[model samples]
Target: MGGKQGPQHPRTPRRRFDIMSRYWTFLLVLVRVILPLKAEETSACPADCACLEPQHHILCSNASLTSVPSILAEGTLELRLDYNNLTSLDTGAFLGLSQLSALHLSYCGLRNIQPGTFEDLHSLEYLHLDNNLLESLEEGTFRNLSRLLYLHLENNKLTFLGPDVFQPMDKLSALYLSHNLLTELSNQTFNDLPQLRWLYLNNNLLSNISIKAFAGPRRLRKLSLEANNLTSVPRALRQASSLQSLRLSSNPIRQLGSFGRKLRSLTELYLDELGLQEVSSTSFAGMRRLRTLSLRGNQLEILSLPLLGAQTELLLSRNPWRCDCRLLWLYVHLQVMKSKVSQGEALCSTPTALAGQRLLNVELQKLTCPAFGSHLTTAAPYKVPTYSATTAKRTPPQVMETPKTTTRTTIVSLATKATQPPPVQHPVPASNAVPERWDPCLAELISKVAVRPKGEGALMVTWSTIGEHDQVEVRYSTGEAVQVLWVTGELAEVELNQLHMDTDYKVCIIPLSKHVAQCTNPNPTQCAMSHTSGWGGHIQPVHMQPTPSHSALGTGVAVAVLILVLVALVLAGAYKLRSRQAGFQRHFDEDGFESERYNPDPYKLDGVYESNEEDRKIFVTAASQWSTEDEDKLDCRLATSPTVLSTPRYVTL
Candidate 1:
């Protein structure tokens, strides 16, 4: 029964939606048989068979075909059509070649390719179009090659790429678009290729990149955009979230600002040969994860804020990094991190303080204040000698010797200075002897003194308007009176000799009536008196010489002659000393005496000398005279040195 049923009817085959089934039966099978596409010898293939396939390669070497062989179609997986005379490729030229895996069209005369030229090469993996006259690519040109993994489009005149020219090759892994004229890239140009890893875009004219242009293919690891004119790190690279290594060694990035934020995933960042001077904070904020950072052959002055990140290895040699206080932090931190990091190259940039010093070997102590102790000492504020009453009046410093005495009054009134005693509180009426409220009585007296500039002797005094009666009296003294020469509102000077210099003046109050000038509120008289008389040095009246009697004149004349002779001797001695000192100076000036051996001899003293030169002259002159005297006459001769040879001495000149 089964045999009878099967004999008379034939059944139709069901449709297949499987891409492989449809493509294979409709395209591959027909292309393999009817096209008779095979080549045996590169030069002797049948006109119908594209070329005889020898070892599965249809080698149409040096083929003079102006167009591709129209009827040649087969399952030939590798096609070598090098040295061809083809100027252009038709979209459907290889329409039925489903098994073509490697296609080499190098050194061909191909000038242009239609949009769908290789759209039917579904199984093609490696396509080489190098050494061709191709200018550029149009969108959808390789639309059907979804499994293409290697695309070589180098050595061509491609100035730029159309936005979606490579959009169809979703599985492409390696691309060779180097040696082109691309200047910039658009965002999403590489968006869908999930399998791309190695991109060689070097040796091109790329200058900039869109921030999101590399936002695809999480596996993209090594990218080389070197040998291009880049003034900055590609913006697309900053957002290249999955990049592991980047090569931007040769560029014109003069400043490293936010430069490291881009390569968060970068293990190695090559920044060598860049023209950089300073690196700021954001340059390494994102590179806290970096393992190796190289900054060789750059123009850097110091390792500043940017280098304060955690890197396993850092290279900063061959750069001119100036080590200074500004670099103190980096200098010290580098040392502590040396043993922790590995394979790092750190070197010095200065040959003085930092000479031959590895950054890792320089400790913070070496840069501390102690290293420049002398400089610090010299720079510190110094203590200078200030003139105070206590200092100015100390033993009334030895007088400077001058030449002549004019009058007896000119003789300085000398006194044995006694140490002062602490102040004592006096009774109120006695203390009030010096009034506090501007002293109307005293003010009138000051007016009188102010009008007396024509008089030979005139005095004026002022006192502060505050303090208790006792404190006020003690504070104000005739000795502290400052004289106003021209009657200006402010006092000009304090004449210490105007009042008793060594006197302790006290006080008494007989009300305002005692003042030389009358007061508005006349109460009792008030006046000051000395607790001790002659408390200060005495003041002799200016007694211009008294007419000398005959006897006195004779005595005076003899004394004057003796004084003149002594002066002559002193002048001679001084001349001799000056000659000796001048001779010494000449020897010194002529280099006859070693300067180090010519230190001052403190034992050879010249009293009250004005300067080192004058002191030397006096010492030499006096010493020569003394050296000639006998021991018995030494005292008298020595005494003569200060008196006979001595210049005039004054207490206050």
Candidate 2:
């Protein structure tokens, strides 16, 4: 019974092993044959290209093929065919590539493409055809590519594009056509691209554009037209209501016209290198939202302050700005908004006296109006409104003629004509006779006071005077103590040696009259106290010493000596090495037996051993005619001795 049970168990195990072998054979056949056949049916890449599976992409760049390979992977998302020799594209060239999203055909020598060539690629979103030889595009060239978002046609020979070339790409967002031969843009060139945001047309030969050329693309944000032959600001830009940045540099535009009321959304306007001689005040009135305005590299001699917005960043460098009275208001406005103007780029380029001076460094007194000739007191009556302390919040005063009884009214009106000010008037005494008293008006004639650092805890204070004054007084405080100094001119230098370094100081200025000593009285009726200047000047005192000229000169001399010594050592070492080489060559030439034993090639010895008598005579004649300098040049070529042979040599003559 035990033997029978053992045999049955062994037979059962053998039966199970047979069934498992058959199952493993079926699985191997499915993996090796059925799965590959199914893959081949789904997608097949061309032999000349590489396919990235799972995410189908074909890479066939620089393959040097004449035509687009037809056997591309079936659901290919991207196909790279750059650097190929494809001269033209047929309608059915991409018949099976309907799933392609991006196509790269740059530098492919593509000169022409038939209409409806890309009709099969309905899902294509990006097309790169730059660096090709295409001269023109047909109206329906991109007929069915409605989903295309970006079209790159830069560096092509495209002289013109059909009006409806981009009509089918309704969803296109960006179109790059730079470095082309386009001469003009017609009205309907980009009519159907409503969603276009960026249009780059730089580095073209564009000289003209239809007035309605940019009427479309209402949602466009940026437009670049640099390096074109435009003679004036394009009137077509008025239709781009949503454009934020517009660059028109490197053009020959001589004058700027009003931007119209359409470009209200523009934030950046670049008109640099346009040869602009003048700009109308209304040229930028419509761009109230503009943040940056660049006028660099132009011929402008003057600019108006009203043309710029308050918060605009102005770039006016490299322009021939004439610094005169006409620009006084602009200089004052720039001073008030100094933080918004670039000091290094704000330079004057005209008027020989003020040329090369920074606009920020120009003093207010130096910007006097030459047209208003003579002093303000002698000029025509320039009305200046005066405010009373009690009626300061009231409306502005009206001009009125003075009565015959008041001689003081005539003098006050004449003085007020010259200055635009908060004038203060004094009551006249009834005595009508000329009193021997200093005029109180001298105290109110001071205009502006400026303070500059002079190192070593010193300050240089300069003020402009409008009327006669005896002296100028300066009062300063260091938060602990107050100090006063009296100076004699429109300019003064004060040394605060007592103040500590790096301490903040508050300073003010006042013009003093000759009656200042008498005005010190507690109840002086004839003398009045003058208005004190505000604390506009805050300075941090710094201690600095003058650089020693002798130390700098000594350093320069030491550097010169060291450089000379280094150059001399280099020349000396080179000379010694050359001399040693020449000595070794001379020594080798003098050893006759050694030269003959080592030098197997005698022709290398500068023709010392000629193969025939004719050659030997030619060499000797050339050597005898050589000049001394030419002979020295041949020292490395020629041996020292002419006959240094151990064995006798024979010529072929």
Candidate 3:
């Protein structure tokens, strides 16, 4: 068999096995030592930076590092390089940080970003570049950051943004571009960001925006354009159906037209510090859901009641409201809803006497119009005596009408007498006697009388005649003196001045006949007076009331009282509820067995129990004979006794 040992494999297989073992040992050593050492060196933090290993957060804030460090861990999730001196972001600045979700480069002195600077940040969700010197961003700079949700570029010097600048960031929700130098926004500036919800463009030099600028973000909820140079409300805003808040403060808008019925979802609106002088009644017609409306610091003189909603929170401070008759409508409306208006801030600015007076303090009675009494009469002419300004006594004067006709009649008689022979005037035939003609004296009745306020201390009395008359006279008396004004038109007006502000006056319209009645004639006929039913005859009294003031005060007081009563009732109810609860708790405590059992008592040795005489004797005897054996026996007896075992009585000596 030894001979057949097969030419002696001579331990060749064993030698190969040994050689393989050594090779494996070397490979193992390389894997366990050399590879780990390399990994450790690669994972080391950059200079002047702090790295959190467990959280994989690298913070290099306030570091003088001129550029982004390349020694970040592969698993870094957040990188904060704020307050650094980074001038520009190269194409592959964040090349390997795939797991990074938040990148903050705020106040980094960053001037520009290359086209592909953020190409490798596929997992980034938040990017903050605020307080930088970046004038503009190259197109496609954030092309690879599709998952980015927030981008803050505030306090930058960006003058413009190219079309489709944020096209690749479809998931972006909030974009803040405040405090920038942007002059305008193109239609396609924010294209393709369908998920965008909040966009802030405040404090920019933006004077114009394309009508379709906000068309790309269909889900937008809030948009702020405050502190811009916009002269009016942008037409672009009506397209956002889901918008909830809009801010246009500190603009140059002079007026506000109706916000088309489409903005039904709008809740908050700010128009403060603008040059607004007028607001259409329908401006907020369809904004039913609006809750907050601010109009502080504007040039508004009056606000219509329909412009404000009942549930809306309004801010109307610093506006110049004229407290006059013209503003009576607003005043009454405010008085009706005094609780809704801001009392201290709603002040008047005109009518020197009312300047600086609060709208709530304005006297509504001070705004008044004259009252008029009208009567129509065609009565016969009666003696209308003329009175002096100083005397209330009246002096009668001769009544004359158609004096020219009388003069013409005398001239005709003289001519006839001169042409005919005087001796031929034998007894005048009865048939030749001249027939008396009716005079034109019936058209002297005033059909209508209208009185209106002329100024602060005057009244304008206007009247219309029912028929044609030669002359119409207006006699008015303020109880002290009577004045007559003769007017010669179908429609006549007399402005009575120097009249007391709040006093009653009697005015009468008298019509005179055109025919004359001579007082020297021995059998002179009296001037006939027409007693027409529709003619104004008697003097009508008109009362001039003071401006409406105290009534509004009474209304305000009533409303305040009602509100106070409601508040007091609510407080009383709350107090009653609290007292009832306290009473119930007291009753429960008085009736509870736990309170009585736990109450301290001087008669008992321990507060837990009140023992009888037999029980006390038993406890004293047990305590006097207390021992280890007795305690065991007692425990055994206690375990066996029905009441002791079942009820577990607590004994106190």
lDDT per model vs. reference: 0.56, 0.69, 0.68
Off by over 4 Å in 3: 1-43, 305-307, 325-343, 351-354, 361-653
Worst 10 residues of 1 by lDDT: 466-475
Could you give candidate 3's per-residue lDDT for residues 125-203 as a string of tens digits?
Answer: 9999999999988778888889999999999999999996887998999999999999999999976889999999999
Ranking by lDDT: 2, 3, 1
TM-score of 2: 0.53
Q: Relative to the unseen true structure, what is the Cα RMSD of model 3?
A: 33.7
Give the best candidate by lDDT: 2
TM-score for each model: 0.44, 0.53, 0.52
lDDT of 2 by residue, 57-92 (tens): 889899887998887765889999999999999888
> Can you list the residue pairs that collide in candidate 2?
none
